[model samples]
Target: MTVDESDAYVLRDELPDPETFAHLREVAGMGPRSLEAIERGLPNTIYGVIAVHEPSGEVIGMGRLVGDGGAVYQISDMAVHPDHQGKGLGTGIMDRLEAHLEAEAPAGAYVNLVADVDDFYERFGYEPVRPGSKGMHRRIE
Candidate 1:
């Protein structure tokens, strides 16, 4: 992030623990995720970025890269706690994740994210692959 955050947060290149991950996701308005899923899926993250509140050492923001390491990569769980929104933690999280892909991903690696917010990912070089190709999903029973 271009904004200075050194005083309040320490950005870490690691995923948060399962409980913290679930809580952060819910408080950030992404809604609650199953602990079962969090535990199962977090281990698969190829790379993750975390923002820790220095005063409390809480994980306030995060983003992760998940997919087969060679060709497919998706930016998932991009969120910042509502109280911490304006400090650029979201962008900082993305910055670290993007840097990881740049250094580690292959020549033709595909990076994508489901942007729930408008225009946020475009600055990071993402465009919609919609209308012609829809993004589909199904919840496991």
Candidate 2:
């Protein structure tokens, strides 16, 4: 019920198990994150897309949308396993996330994301917020 048929890979509209989520992020070069954060944050995802390698049933890619549904939303934790690069899985994930946002977010809702590469996100109508606003964040130890 979670995965679609006809392929060695599939996308599921659900959160990956925490272990898979963390593992994919690391293998995808996103760096390791606190397990505590993963546990605390995943449940709050307004939507999550996970790519599974059907042969292994391994979650090899993921992306999440988080924030207040009516006003603020962000596309976060996007990553694909290194072995799965150049296969358009990222695009597939983003397409899913964007569709969900388009359907669920309010007309004026502000959607944002911290993009590692601008060009990839540009294809999705996301542009730099520069000249108006900049992204800032702080780490909590």
Candidate 3:
């Protein structure tokens, strides 16, 4: 899917080039788990999208949906370069991601994400998992 923004940005699902992925990692302050997952090819299950600055051919923003591809999908690693944060790039990326999920994920699949910003994701139909539901994690030490 291609999403063209009025600002001359374009969104495409072509797996990000390595340099772009590295830029995304740096912008997001991603930790070892993210590094490992990205490096070990584990996030290959990822559905990745990038916001490109057409004139420069630079990736200014990115996000990914990762899961088993059938039942559970989580939006993760969403980021926009600090220089580009206020211009709606993040929202554009999510718009594309949500559209993909709506069209492709199987019926009854639970789409989930951990949001660093409270109100931003609500606009996209994501709500916190109910209070008692656990969000678990294990990190390599």
Question: What TM-score, over all chains together, does every model reach?
Answer: 0.91, 0.92, 0.82
Q: What overall lDDT goes with each candidate model?
A: 0.88, 0.88, 0.77
In candidate 2, stretches whose alpha carbon ends up further than 4 angstroms from where it belongs are 1-7
The collision pairs in model 2 are: none
Superposed model 1: Cα runs more than 4 Å off: 1-7
Candidate 3 stretches with Cα past 4 Å from truth are: 1-7, 32-36
The TM-score that candidate 2 achieves is 0.92
Model 3: per-residue Cα lDDT over 38-103, one tens digit each: 665534645778888887778888888888899999898788878767888889889888889988
Q: Per-residue lDDT of 1-141 in model 2, one digit per residue for the tens?
A: 564443468899999988888888888777688889899889998999999988878788999999988899999999998887787999999999999988888889999999886589999999999989978988777
* lDDT score, candidate 3, position 101: 93
Query: lDDT tens string, model 1, 13-105?
Result: 999999989988888778678999999999999999999999778889989999999999999999888988888888899889889999999
Clashes within 3 Å, all models in order: 0, 0, 0
Ranking by TM-score: 2, 1, 3
Candidate with top lDDT is: 1
